[model samples]
Target: MLGEPAAMTENTGDTPRTLRLRADDNVAIVVNAFGLPAGTVFADGLTLLEFVPQGHKVALVDIPQGGTVVRYGEVVGIALRPLPRGSWVEESSVETPVAPDLDALEKATRVPAPLPPLDGYTFEGYRNPDGSVGTKNILAISISVQCVAGTLDVAIRRIKQELLPRYPNVDDVVGLTHAYGCGVAINAPEAVIPIRTLQSLARNPNFGGEVMVVGLGCEKLVSERLLPAGDVAADTGVVRLQDERHAGFGMMLDSIMTMAEARLEVLNRRTRETCPAADLVVGLQCGGSDAFSGVTANPALGHAADLLVRCGATVLFSEVTEVRDAIHLLTPRAASPEIADALIREMAWYDDYLAKGGADRRANPSPGNKKGGLNNIVEKALGSVAKSGTSAITGVLAPGERVRDKGLIFAATPASDFVCGTLQLASGITLQVFSTGRGTPYGLAHAPVIKVATRTELAERWSDLIDLDAGRIATGHATIEEMGEELFRLILDVASGHKQPWSDRWGLFNDLTLFNPAPIT
Candidate 1:
């Protein structure tokens, strides 16, 4: 009766956790932590007519035929008829009707729609040679091939310790080592040639003027060897990976120091200016989401995203599957018929991917989200979409497309945070505003990731990880507006070369550029 408290506990199986929705209702809502069959009966005085999977709802009390199902202390939907005492609630689920699926009638409720003005707001950001800004002046070491990447990484580690006693502004000297960059035909030139080695490491706005890159001179990708005379070659050091095994490594270290010394002298020239919000491209993301996400953190960020859009900044929000269940909310937001069609195409792709994996997002989710009370993808997407903050859908993006227009952008990704982060960075995102309801250490490589926490306990416990506390909305200490503004300032600091909540203290700067998509085939 202790572990098997189906008679007492809200869900059956593991730990002693139970929940009651109504005071007047009888019989307990039994959550089966384990998958017991339709006819399985527990020793704790409870029997199961059908199994209730984890993160799905169950009956807290017996319901008469046609009775209402209450959740969040409100009538979510009507029970699809009668249920026996102490039986798991199945088939019946919460479904709110909508007129349009992507850009539709979501404002039927009394809550006001987002209508922030587009005036007097801007982020003073730089547009580089490749149309990106260098938020921080970084000195980096990149290897065009993985074979000699170890030598470069080993040398960089030693150099960090060697220079730590001198260069305080030298944020981090890291190695951008990856599996690709070679083994492909370099002679075959196309419209968008393979510049994987140069772009992610060199063009990444975080790195300043001078840098070092070592290459194997003979790999199939020998573009690092082909150079426009006197420009990139004048400052770059490209040594053959096969160099006498020892002279190459020594020359690389010497080149790094030479570049570092030159970059240090110009650190004084960095300045912050008031650039228009049009220059800013904010990326919207949510991880470790919970039941309270739509009610709190996600919507708060959505408002902030709307503010940026109103000020002329383009906001890019990813994770298509997370929003698949909330298709009804996006119906009215789509600006035209084509955008709605594109949105539907991406959703169908996500469903196909899920089917290939043999799992539905509703039936399976990350364990952390389940622990935080999320039911399914529908509920998750409904709450997740709230982060867009009600801005009009000016544009939508494919997996790695750069967001060219301002407004709310529904971008697609593979749902891996690290991979998604890389794709967004490569797609030209200047910064990423990530909100986590439960808790997460996820961040993007090469771009600034501002983490907002949704719970007060998580905020206090892991203050170092959380930059903004949306949890105050949950506890009544701060309004969403206050938190939204706070997050905005944090974004400005990050764009102005200020340290992130953790990076300022720990001196950690990430330069991860992962491209998971097939190479433009």
Candidate 2:
């Protein structure tokens, strides 16, 4: 079921940025910043976009500082003061931020640009019979409903997990459990987030095949929809637990053994190879983002993101709320008018969403971020926007959607890490660069997350869980350039079948907590 893996290249030197980040504009980014700058003209090793120095000007010309700064064609923040031409654009700062300052800042983020190139890129993944790509190798046993989840988990757990040594290529073996498979209305679905989670898991590419139904049978979510039920290539077949055929848990395990064993040869048949950078679809995600997250991890990763984009890898950054302060930086890259229009629509949607007695994303910055020293959401958004680098804003998306385009893109969702990460994974990412402040163990079924931390303290505290740490930059022992290059190589290691830190190696791809959009019927 696994196809050839995606390709990788030698270190992508810093991407060149053409749009000069003038000292005067609050917004600073260029559509094309690909070459190195001469000494003194721009700071060396600063990487303003991706490895561009902090003083690099995406806009050579400038306007009054108090005037709005536009990048992707939106207002990320307002100028704290007036500015002169050729001055570096500073991100908009709020006046007594919690007061009236938010109105102007939120308007500056989530704009559009042309879609970056999408050709000549691919990751080596298992393409299910349905044509989806998976990043890892996993054996999946789907339970039809909550009724039989326990029985199936027991059957899965009883298997010799240690025996995986015989199958070095496999990522993990897991039983897909749900809080509901039965007991809920079959059609009670009304844009339920968890329902989308089930479909996401069933649709994930990391899994080799599924053998399941309710351990009892008659569950609404039978093998018919969950597994590739009748597909031979998927090496899949669905059986009901209540079926007179596969009667007991013992019998189910035996059946699973035979079913799982048959896929070993196919799973082992795959191996890693060099692919272009663009072939790698690493989800650029942040969670448990605190004030420092935007300031530290977010922008640091953005530097790497711009480098990857320049090298031609597909980078997907999500959570529209997190980018609220800098949506304007993304708009200029809009792939189409529809994408641009969708961007505007969601902007208003979020605006009205907040005005209705509910706070908008600004209030959504987590408590950890506040305690870790983030002040308010606007400041957090300003920092979070840096993760996208300086690539064009190719497309704007809502949750539970597909991304077939390239360049710098956004997938919209509330501020939950797993929710946005899962949506990006479902779209097509075998790897993810996850930055976190406080600790949380969240991993997708197939996507082997490359975890990063915002600060050095959290990095040392959770070193075992983290794959890379940019926090050292905060400590001054390391620079963003050093960290960015380190992260780029680490990405290659994960893609090459090296076991990731957060995974149990049982291939726990939980899509049960996802949110997907429904096609209009």
Which candidate leads in TM-score? Answer: 1
What TM-score does each of the candidates earn? 0.70, 0.68
For candidate 2, write residues 11-109 as lDDT tens digits: 223433232222333333322222233331333222332232231223333445455544323243455765443343433232213322222323324
Q: Which whole-number lDDT from 0 to 100 does residue 234 have in model 1?
A: 28
Query: In angstroms, how far off is 446's CA in candidate 2?
Result: 2.9
Q: Candidate 1: where is the Cα deviation over 4 Å?
A: 1-118, 122-132, 140-142, 158-171, 182-202, 208-213, 218-240, 243-248, 255-269, 353-364, 497-499, 508-521
lDDT of 1 by residue, 462-510 (tens): 8888887776664445666777777776777777665565634544444
Clash count in backbone of candidate 2: 77
Runs of candidate 2 with Cα error greater than 4 angstroms are 1-134, 162-166, 183-197, 208-216, 227-236, 345-362, 475-478, 502-512, 516-521
